[model samples]
Target: MDARRDAAEDGRETIGISWSSPTRPARRDRRQRPCAVDPVMEIEIVHLDRRHAGLRIADPARLAHLVGSLARHGQQSPVLLVKVEDRTVLVDGYLRVTALTDLGRDLVDAVVLDHVDEVGALLLRHRLQARRSTALEDGWLLIELLEVHHRTQADLATVLQKSTSWVSRRLALARALPALVQEAVRVGSMPPHAAMKFLVPLARANAADCEAVVVALGHQRVTTREIERLYLAWRRGDPEQRARIISNPRLFLKVEAELEVPPVAPDETSALVDDLEGVAGLCRRARKRLRTGVLERASASERAPVAAAWRETREALRTLAARMDAEEFDGRPRDTHRDPAAGQRRPQPSPDREDVEGVTEHRQEDPRGANTRGPTLRSGIEAPAPSDADP
Candidate 1:
């Protein structure tokens, strides 16, 4: 038997053994025979290499925490790596490697896989183990596996330990959102579901408009409902309306109103009209008083308390306006209109006599309608009838 010691200057050591027999062939012992071992299953120290596909984007705060944990307890989990022709690529455990590197470690423990499929499966396993993967991360991984690797969704689903539907949804979300929107989601500017729900449909319907809206509101953290409404308004509105909605969405959403006018007896028509005019005058007076007494005087320090009071009043009015827009008032569908320039209230178009009579008849039939307020004028006075030859 001959034994040799091979030592590298870097302190790495290797041992080799050989036996020579004369006259008789050496019989190998069954127990000592070399058994095939998967290199992917073995954990060994390796040089950290980052030039590889990974789903996780390193977070500074999380990396800091990992650095601290590693400094105290050392690396509890081995990172996964894939061996290519001449280089090793990272598959998972980016944070661990990053922490270890920051700690001035020369080597990292890794499980190196030979095949790309095994690499993908282990990537997903590590992702699940970390439990920090976002939908966008899943989306990116799904795309890599399906498009780049040419893998089926079923195969990925099995590898990811998720339902086929889950894989499909992630892929669909990735495909539906534009690259800009995806970046916005990735950087925490836009939420994943918001991008998937609002921007995806907008992109499908009109890519230019979707891009425009994203460019406009990408910096703001908009809610899902706000995004939905903004998309709807953009889809249905003209250029000016779209701009208005994007700039002041809450104002646009709150400006909608439905108005219905009921018919009165021909003899009582004049009186009903006069009462509406009176109500309109009262509202105009109240608005004028509020504008002059509170808003105009708001700059004065003496009026600070009054300004605070006005804020409460304004909120209450907004609540009332929203409620009024939603429900009918005075036994009629409430007539509401908003002047785009000033955001002021305007009356809805008056119902025709026939429609008014229909509502009147319904009100008589339903006793509950009697308890509600009578048809209220939304806007004060009617516009003058157009002259027959005006055109």
Candidate 2:
């Protein structure tokens, strides 16, 4: 979707406009009042104001997914809105509104909040959608509030019910992340979550390094795993190593590719035993961490992101267990949504369980249910965060 077009024609497509007051009252900075939500109603797409749409990071993947959902199930959720001098201004659900536009939708399910100005609506949106928000999104949103709305950090902290330090950290996310990286995220050239997790701190450690890395990456579709690898290596590596990473990440990846050393194969029966022991050890360790983790020490709002992350982790483990059960019953293969080796040649089975030269060890899926044999398979799990980073 062309983001620029969103701001262009509010009246371009006329579909099911319930209210058609041509009088657009002038916008003003007014005092915020209590939220007054109207029942969900259909509003004309052309009448909706999306002047603040540019403030959001434009993610094509997210928009595509939303478009598909809206197409399949219709707009089950409502877009948030506020009355600005009688003009209905969008406060949240830009993606949903965009999806409706893509689907040639005339009207949108809207929750118009009364008695609140633009500033109050934005704060309400932040509180309402904090769970689904990424650090990049939150940073930019906070920046919008601080600079565009002329809000002080202390005032924002008080309204958001957070400490001033927490507000600064969130502001620092935008202040600290390189503008180059921020643009990359905004245009979908880079991922917002990966930037939040790996690149922000990398940028703060050395802004030039962040700039160099962003320039080196260009517009390539990099993964969370690759970015994570680069960040960890850069964190620990020396000056020469870090420079090489910034200037020539591909070469770093090439060197990172395990040299043609064949991992010694363990006895099959013993390997099974070792794998079971490893799984048990991991479970025990995870349980111990959960028992002693910072959840008990954190406040309610502070613990929200962490608790949400845990729910995701729990759901993922549940899915894995279900997949395992399915495999036990049917031994069928699962579809790959994103595969690096989509067009790669089938790896030949190693005779006598011996390693083959030039054949890299990757734990990839085969839709054909073929047993792929290799000397070793490297784990590709994302590195677990020691603690959840506040979004």
Candidate 3:
């Protein structure tokens, strides 16, 4: 008997099953007798073992959990089964039915269909059905079902899941990972959840560099931040930056040496005593002289050029500091975003420190007159008070 006919006889295939819109009901003959049972409403257990189940049952935990639930409350749904000679086979519901058995339910409720195709049409039909329905991560659903079916390399088309070749192609990306990276993933050192997110981008950019970073990270005990640092360095850091480490073999060796070597102790006794006595004598003489000789020599040396340069630098720094403070007070700030070309510099106190006393009225003249293109404007200069005269 045809499966369609069997489905119709069992009432499992309702009149409006296929189409989105309902079809008109057939006019019943007046002589037709009413049946005792509504076939569609009844749940019966049919043994269907010969059918090839290709959907993966990979997550055993989930399966066990479902089984536990089923144990508490018997199989609420019937599995679709088709008769094949002496044996009835499962057409769908692989995991759910497995859960039923695991839950210790000896029998399953099933709808009996007449024919069982030698090749599983269920797998193809399911994929086609899924394809029409929604999007998914690359072969994720099919892969899961294959695992459930325990058919890793089975012909997917016949199994109605995925072809063996297709599974191989998709698996290779993950399977071909470096042993060290794989180990890291397995050990929970690298988050398995984010491994793919890290892997795909790295592998696409430079497989060798990706492998190097992974291996390098594995050797040292590293934190997630360090791993992220290395991973991102490869992603966005320039080629020169990557080459600085990779090209220099000695750097790694230097790190190793630092790790292996112990600290050195300072020479004691004579060195300590001689250094202390000499320091004490110099200190006493320097204190007695009050560094007058050093000062006399410094002044006598006609260091006008050096003095002028120092004075100018000090004044410029002071002006800058004043400007910065003014900007801060006014709520207008300078640029803070990093500029690669500008590089980094240590901050110095501005030259405006002494100017705060208001001795010079023209202090607003940018102390660095030549640094900017604009002409410097001079304000009125104020004389020092007689008591506050310069020394």
Candidate 4:
């Protein structure tokens, strides 16, 4: 016989026990069995313990209302359970059982069923009830129901009395999301399928950044086009676009500025050129000032002024000639005292700051710090020697 027909036949039998208390019945009374030899699959009321189902029925509001009704009038409907290893297991109406338990009922009505495996029961329960649940919740139920059963989408649709397309679409949406976004969908702030699309951009963002984006999309009533625009920009990885999104107020400001500003006259080209020339002139003056400052600093140094910084061009030429002579020296030790003008080695001076005027000869200072010839003025001004100008 077909399983449904058999279950229906078994369901017609009267278990013949009052659900007033736990010790009311031990086993189903044989007399209340279906009189017909071929029983049809249908559910009937019986006495049974309504715990240990392990499946969560997510309709809390319905359950609470049902509990309140049961509290006043007592259970009128029978929960369905299947026999497993000499123990009865709940197959359907877990919420009803929960409502009855919450109402403090000692015993409740149920139907004894042939053992349908965990998968079949889960699929039946979800199909019968959880279809009314939110997409995210339904997705979780489907996953939980399938984990032990390992049913394909077509099998799920067949057993659950739903279309294969519906099952596939919902499963795809649920599985596409990361855990955190799934939580958001469960909490009902985001639409489950729409939230999947949002994840594409949000995965690139950090937690806080994602929160900001979610808030913006949630609060701004942002259109699909606006969201797509932002998402595409994010994917392009443009720094300027990212900054614009980060500071959205600036985008408004830019638009406002454009609206308020006046257009420039096409014939006023001379003014733009004049402005460019003014900027160029200012840059030129700044360069000149910087060069002059450097020259003054070099000239004031205690050592001889750098040749390049000298005011007279002749001094620069002489400095270049002296550098060339040093670089082109052949087979001779480099003489620091060589004069470029005279082309010969010059006399060395004492370590002390002194000047000697037109003196081609020199006397070395004694260790006692005295020289037989005293210091004399050099060829130039006698105001102070270049080295003596230090202090």
Q: Which candidate is the best by lDDT?
A: 2
> Which of the two, 1 or 3, has more lDDT?
1
**Cα error, candidate 1, residue 235 (Å):** 5.2
lDDT of 1: 0.54
As for lDDT, the candidate ahead, 1 or 2, is: 2
Q: After superposition, how far is residue 217 of candidate 1 from its true place, in Å?
A: 4.6
lDDT per residue (tens digit) for residues 263-311 in model 3:
7676796785686466456535633553354333444334454345435
In order of appearance, the predictions have TM-scores of: 0.43, 0.52, 0.30, 0.35
Report lDDT (CA) for all predictions: 0.54, 0.66, 0.45, 0.48
lDDT of each residue in 133-205, candidate 2, tens digit only: 6666767878988888889988998998989898788788777788888888877778877888888889878
Cα error, candidate 2, residue 288 (Å): 30
Q: On residues 1-391, what C-alpha lDDT tens digit does candidate 1 reach at each position?
A: 1111111111111111012134454233444222221322324235445644345543455567667766865654345566655666666666666677689886765555444444454444544342455676788877876776788888877866789999888787778777877777755566667777778888887776677667777476767877777777788889788778766555555664222246554767688668656756855675566545444434556455654654564455445435445555579754443212334454334442212211111112246433222222333322111122222
Greater-TM-score candidate between 3 and 4: 4
Ranking by lDDT: 2, 1, 4, 3
Winner by lDDT between candidate 4 and candidate 2: 2
> Which window of ten consecutive residues has the lowest lDDT sum in model 3?
381-390
Best by TM-score: 2
lDDT of 3: 0.45
